[model samples]
Structure formats: structure tokens, C-alpha cells
Target: MENKIHFQYLIDGDDFTRAGEASSDIKSKLKMMNINPDAVRRVAIAMYEGEINMIIHADGGTIDVDVYPDKLTMVLKDTGPGIPDIDKAMEEGYSTAPDNIVSLGFGAGMGLPNMKRASDEMEISSVVGQGTTVTMTVLF
Candidate 1:
């Protein structure tokens, strides 16, 4: 079996019912590969959060995942309005989601903070009008 694997998934912006499918698939694959439960949980949670963020804020996006013997990497790219303040965005309770979004059970504003806490390292590149890309790595 290969010690490394790379996978990419497209997040459909219009499908609220299918938001976490990619993360679920990855979790299943990691389990079949015998990855630790804790590791799989972290990956799933962080990636799921990113996916929801893309759906809620970006209008849709892409997720790339690299699985290695000792680390896992995820990159989420979106085309929606980019974050104006990364610093504020990182704060646990700071969120700009609309009331409509909150009514749907998301937008608690814990996406970035939770992703950072779940991964070993995280980087964000965003432009106000261009887009946002988040790269996160978890060490095994």
C-alpha cells in the first residue's frame, strides 16, 4: 500500500444537504487504511468545518487533501467574498454570517478557531475581492 495519497473534492455551493459528504468519504477511507481514530476525527472535523465555511461564505469551493505517513494536509479554496479581517475572523465568537445562515444551524464563528486547534499549523491567503484559500496541516 502507498504511504501517501492525495485527494481533491469540489464543494457544491447550492447543496446544503450534501455539505459534509467529502469529509465523510475521507474519514471512511482513513478508517479503512487503519488510521488512528483520533486522527481521523480531527481531519473530519476540521475539513467539515472548512467545507461548511465554503458553502456558507464562499458560495462553493474546492478541498485538496494529502495523506502521509506522519502528516495530513488540507487546502480549501473558495471564490466568495474574501474575509476582510483575518484577525477578527480567527476570534471564536466573531462572525459575519447573515441571519439566514444562522437560522440554518451554522455560523457559530468557530470554524477558523476550531480548524487551528485541530491542526498543527494553518495558513490563510485571502483578498477582499478575489477569494480565500486556507491551508492546514496535521502532524501524525
Candidate 2:
């Protein structure tokens, strides 16, 4: 484990207040570790998007983060109603968020797109009635 740090967080469904907690914590840690500011910003944005998705769509889930000298990786997993169409979901402004969520000023359909744009690489796996797992990485 040469210069590697790992962390795990549990997200509460419908908890808009806590949606960005994990990402904020990670950002603080990264800054304390003297990580590149650009990389830290990317990680925070991507992770925060994932957290918001879990709260709105997945009804809660877990996020795992691994930080290393050369890169950082994040894995977000949720057991909520899985995505039926990944390709369509990838399209910007294509969101399945409920009306109530939209009313709260969230779920603008940009979560996944922003996450992908912030990360060096991203992968998503989902099962219709099972769950969704998103993995993202940013290189320093």
C-alpha cells in the first residue's frame, strides 16, 4: 500500500442535506495531502454527482474511494431500481428523476455527464431491477 488511502461512505436516500458530505470530506483530505488542485476539484465534482444520484435515484448506497500518488478512484454502488437504458442515460439532460426531485432544484440530468467529464475514465454497470455501480478515476 505505497502511498494509498482508502475511505468508504454510506449515503442516505432522500437526504439532500448530506448529499455532498463524502465529496466534501474527500476534497478536504486531498487538499491537506497537497494533491494537485485541479485533480482535487475533479474528484470532488465527480463524487458529489455520484452522491446526489444515489440520494435521488438509488435511494441510498455506498461510495468507496481510493487515493494514490498517481491517481484516485471512486466506486459508487446503489441497490435501487437500476437503469434500464445506459446509453440514453448517458445523454446530457436525459434524467429519470421524479417531479418532486426536480421541484427541489436537482436532477437536471447532468450528473452522469458531469461525472464523466470530470474523471479521466468512467464505467457504469446496472441491472434493471437490481442496482447500479459506477466507477470513476482521475489521474494526477
Candidate 3:
């Protein structure tokens, strides 16, 4: 069997203080495993973006990470309002975040863009009034 390490995290959407905690933990683990710094950085950035999106858009969600010898995979899922237009959402600086969220120094509309840039591969799937799921991978 292929060697792999897996982790799952439950994001608390209502708690801004806990935001990025999951990503931070994963970063540390990757570093400890002697993963390349570039790959670790990419994973951290992508995963952090996903976490913030879940907190800002979805009420709460789950993140799953799988670490393999050659790459890292991250999946984020939330049952909040789904993206109405994936194309528009993919555009930089286009955000549906409310004023209050923007006031908190988030919702700058860079989350998805940044996540995509950081990961080697990224995919998004959503259902209106249901939720959104994002999968990202970074090659080591």
C-alpha cells in the first residue's frame, strides 16, 4: 500500500479567532515531515484561504488533508449558501461577502484566487442553497 498521512478538521465558522488553526497545524506537520519548503508554503496558503472562505461564507465546514510522498491534497466542504456563479466568483476582487465581514478585514475577494494560485491543481463544486466543496493539491 502507498504511504500516506490523513487529517480531518472541523471548522468553527463563528469563531474568527480560531481561523487558520487547521492550516497552521498542517504546516507544522509538513515541515516536521521534511517536505519541501515550497510545497509546504503552497499548502499552507491554499488551505488557509479555504479555511477563511468557509468561515466567511459557509456557517461552518470540514477540511480533509492527505499527505503523500509526492503531493498533498486538501478538500474543504461547507453546507452554507453555494456559489451562484462559479465564473464570477473565480474572478479576482469579486466578492459576495457582506459589509460586516468586509469590515472585519476579510472578504477582500482574494480567497479563491489565492487558493488557486497556490495549489498545483484546484477544483470546485457547489449546489445552490446547499453548499460548496473545494479540492486542492500541491505537488512536493
Top TM-score hit: 3
Model 3 — TM-score against the truth?
0.97
Mark the regions of model 2 whose C-alpha exceeds 4 Å error after superposition: none
Ranking under lDDT, best-scoring first? 3, 2, 1
Structure candidate 1, residue pairs in collision: none
Candidate 2: which pairs clash? Answer: none
**lDDT for each residue of candidate 1 in 1-140, tens digit (9 for 90 to 100):** 38879999999998878999999999999999888889899999899999999998988899999999888999999988999999999999889988788888888888899999988899999999889999998876
Candidate 1 stretches with Cα past 4 Å from truth are 1-3
TM-score of each: 0.95, 0.96, 0.97
Q: Candidate 2's C-alpha lDDT?
A: 0.93
lDDT of 3 by residue, 78-121 (tens): 99999999999999999999988888888988999999999999
How far residue 1's Cα lies from its native spot in candidate 2, in Å, is 5.2
Model 2 C-alpha lDDT per residue in residues 37-119, reported as the tens digit of each score: 99999999999999999999889999999998999999999999999999999999999998988887778899999999999
lDDT of candidates 1 onward, in order = 0.91, 0.93, 0.93
RMSD of each predicted structure: 1.7, 1.0, 0.9
